[model samples]
Target: MTHILQIDSSPRLERSHSRALASAFLEQWKPYHPGAIITHRDLVRDPVPYLDATWITAKFTAAAAIALSDELVDEFLAADCYVLSAPMYNFGIPAVLKSYIDYIVRPKRTFAVTENGFKGLITHKKMILVQARGSDFRYGSAYASMNFQEPYLKTVFGFIGITDIEVINANRLNTELRDQELAAARTTIQALAATW
Candidate 1:
């Protein structure tokens, strides 16, 4: 069975647009893959701890060189796909979400050094990022220059071998263009849900 890890980063519960979009995506995805197992992680409600000296030392040490904890390695390997709902905060991801990333992207775990430069250990995994922003950042728009969330996520997740990543952005949440942007995002979500 397929395993999907759903992560929500917004502190706002019902008011969060990203969470709404992700819920819609899951509703659509369920029927298509009835056997899929879903695991939910609400970062805002239950925050992940930031990395510290122990985690750093564990990450850098060889897989066989140090006695690594099974809990740490199991968390990274437990999913076949991830659905992340993140709202753009100050032109980037929220601090809580960033902390979760710091905890998961461990060396000799999620990734490792190889003879061909560096290689990510996690493979054949898909990721879907649902982003909500206060300003419109669609291509060719003036506010497009302000978008950093998508690119940053792409870079970081790519580093861990999550190349099959897709983003559905719900932009202009607090602006005059809110309704139009949301409609567009919903349409995109519908299409992606059909094919993804």
Candidate 2:
């Protein structure tokens, strides 16, 4: 059976665009694959703690000490696909999502430094990033060059072998173009859900 891991990092509930898009995607996707198993991780509700001294020491010392990290990595590795929803905060992703990444991206867990440079242990997975931005940051826009979310997310996930990344950016949410942009994003999400 296909296993899907759905992660939502947006702190907002009713007004969260990214979270709604993610739900819309899932709503459309479920019909296509009815038996797919799904796991939900809401970072806002159950926040993953930032890496502390013990967690840092555990990375190089005893494997057993890294219990939480191991659990996070194992959960990540168990999924065949992932739907990650987050809002761009100060040109980057939310702190909760970043903390979750820190927990999972362990040295010998998700990746490793090998003779060939860096090796990503997690393989053969696809990811859909449902991102909500406050301004117009799409390519060619004046503020496009200022976006730090996409590049950082792709790089970090790519480091762990998830190279097939698709992004659905709902930009200009804080402007008059909010309705138009949100509708366009919904349309895109619906189309992608049918195929991806």
Worst 10 contiguous positions by lDDT, candidate 1: 63-72
Model 1: runs farther than 4 Å from truth? 62-73
Q: Name the top lDDT candidate.
A: 2
Error of 1 at 99 (Å): 0.6
Q: Flag clash pairs in model 1.
A: none
RMSD of each: 2.6, 1.0
Q: What is the lDDT of residue 173 in candidate 1?
A: 87
Every model's TM-score: 0.90, 0.97
Task: Provide the clash count, candidate 1.
Answer: 0
**Number of clashes recorded per candidate:** 0, 0
